[model samples]
Each structure stands twice: as structure tokens, then as C-alpha cells.
Target: MNPLDPAGIFISFEGGDGVGKSTQSRLLGEWLREVTGRVVVWTREPGGTDLGRVLRQEVLHGDDMDPRTEALLYAADRAHHVATVVRPALERGDVVITDRYLDSSVAYQAGGRSLAADEVERLSLWAVEDLLPHLTILLDLDPTVGAARLTDAPDRLERAGDEFHLRTRQAFLDRSAQDPARWLVLDASGTQEDIHDAIRAAVVTRLGDALGVADGASLGEREVG
Candidate 1:
């Protein structure tokens, strides 16, 4: 457990838009709750809390802002989320699975917006007090292919040009490569069930007896909060 959050397991799913991160994150959260019987907090950045919803709307749907303004807005949402929702859940020893985390800011602001990567990362670390996820799943897929999967009206990021998304995809790959032990990179082109199975296997291996899964001992009932 890190100093900011003394307990609980933190997991995150990340990828380019339409890589099925939401589907996979929810599936893994449900499976974790079913097998481990622990509280699973399924959430996402820029929309995790009430305040986050406002920020999300502004960042994605409202008027366009400069890159710095965009980065700061994301950081603001993240800081509040960690302080209110995430840190409290961790302190209660619940499992927290997020759809995206600091990595998204880095990918979007730094990679897509061409801002300084270090600056972007440092801003996020400061916001969350360096509370990195225990595990981060990067669903790797071609940006074009992933974009093809989106059905809703494209948001600001989704509407970003091809080159922007290509850079964002590369940024995610680079981050995963830098931390292979903490990251599970999988081919997102596969079926959702296949991705879930792979995530479960890795999680089982990573969590083990620490989470009482070494012998299938149920932890508690699943609670999504």
C-alpha cells in the first residue's frame, strides 16, 4: 500500500478510443467481485465524481481550450477524484478498477496535443500524490481500427485527426514498455471474453494469496461504489 492509500488494489484499463476499455474494465470488476467477493469500484477519469462530470463535459463537449488549459482541467478532475472517491475506497480496502487514469492525460495532452510529456506526467502525479495503480492493462490496437468501433457522435478527442491518435497510441505503448511488470498489454482486436480471460489470469497471478485468491477464498460481496 502506498502512503496516500494504505489498502486496496488499484487497477486501470487503458487504450485508444473504442478499444473496449469500458467493457473490459466492467467485466474484470464484476469477475473480481464474483470470485473474490470484494468491493469493486468501477470508475473513469474526467467523469468519476459530480464535479468530474462538469469537467468532462467542458473538456470534451464544451468550447475548445488551449493545451495548457486542457491539461489543467484534467488534473483538476483527477485531484478531486483521488481525494474524494478513490483514496477513500482504497483506505476501506476495496478494489478500484478505473477505465482511465493519469495515463490518459499524458496520452491526450502530451501525445495528442504535443505538450511536454514530463510536464504532463508530473502534473498528474502531483494531483494524485503519486498514487500509481497496482496494475494497468493496455489494450493494444490500431488507432484506425479502434476508431471504427465507435458509434456515438465523436467527442473532441475522438474527432482528433489520425496523426494525433497515432501519437496517443504510441504514447500508451511507450508507457507500458517502460513498466512491463505493472502493465499488461494485450491485443484489443480479440473478443471481449478473450480479453477478460487474459486479464483475469494476469490479475490472479498478480494478486494471489495477498487477496485470498490463492485458494479461491471469497473476500466479500461485490459492491460497486
Candidate 2:
């Protein structure tokens, strides 16, 4: 196992597309910055480093790629991200918050596209070198509700079909069910404020005193009213 710096904490947020991961991640990143003493680095899989960003565009939006090829591309991006961004940050004792991680591949490729889950898991482990986040927060929302949250035209995977997203959503929830220790399911049907509060609570509970954010402080507690 690679050494984790005493101050390092890795937390990942996950969900199907349009589940407000981006928004919630940003909110939590800011909260961590203000409340925690450790250096906080915010990034995402498939696009954290420069190389990963280019691959992200090609992988997520490229409609011509084969399913197996797509899975490999995602793994490739994660390799770069884990090495170039995630590992180094953890070594530096920084708190790293990623918008998504390996679970996304299991949910999107294997569960959504009906590919073999074991293959995806094997590839992901090879890519990430078994580096698991200290905590993974899964935002749970219905496929239709999630799809409705998208304002712009959907991308290739986003447009895969309602059934595809339904499977993807269930995949994330199932993942949480299987690993209740490291994963938590956050209901996403509430208002943004409510959802954010729930996320902060989950983080505080999971991270405990390590986050330095106090057990009872709402995310709103950091905001200027």
C-alpha cells in the first residue's frame, strides 16, 4: 500500500449524469477549504489533469468508440489522474475531493451498457492500483428527475436512453448497498440547500474530526448570510 500523508484524506462524490455532482462538489470543496487546515485539491476522474481532460472529451462524448474500448480509455485517463494528481496530493497531505472515481465506470459501462462488471473492476484496479477513497458519497436520484436537471443537449452517454440511466442509477445505489462501510447514499430529490446540508452531514459523520469541520456545522454555516 502506498503511504498516505498524515493529513491526506480522499473523498469521492458519485452519481449518474445530471445528479448535481458538479454543483455539490464545488460546494463541498469550498467548505473544505474554509473549514479545514489541510491543503484542499478539487478534481475529477476522466478529467482532472490536462491529459485526462482531452481523454474525457473523447471518451464521454465520442459516439464511435467500442464499449470495451471506452472502458479502457476511461482506465487510461484514471491512470494519469491518479498518478499525476491524486497520488501526489495525498503525499503532500492535502485533502483531495474528486467528483467521480472507479465506481463511475462500473455504473456507466458495466451496469448501464450491459458489459461484464468483473472486467471493468479488474481494469479499474489495475489502473488505480487499488487506491480507494476514504469515503464515497453517492447521490441517489431517479433517472427521470436526473435527466430533467440537464439544461443543455445531452452527450452520447447521457443520451444513451432512459433505461440506460435507470440502470446506471440503480448501479450506484447497489454499489452503496454492497459497501456500506465506504459508501453513503444521499437522497437528491430535495432542494439544493437541503441536499447540500445532507452532504455536509454525511461528510462530517464519515470523516469525523479529520475534516476539521466540526460535527454540527452545516455547510451553510460557512456561508455569509
CA shift at 131, candidate 2, in angstroms?
Answer: 0.5
**Segments of candidate 2 deviating more than 4 angstroms:** 1-6, 219-225
TM-score result, candidate 2: 0.92
- Alpha-carbon lDDT of model 1: 0.88
lDDT of 2 by residue, 94-124 (tens): 8899999999999999999869888898899
Q: Candidate 1: give the clashing pairs.
A: 37-220
The C-alpha TM-scores of every prediction are: 0.93, 0.92
Runs of candidate 1 exceeding 4 Å displacement: 1-6, 215-225
> 143 in model 2: Cα distance from truth in Å?
1.1
Model 2: residue 65 alpha-carbon error in angstroms: 1.6
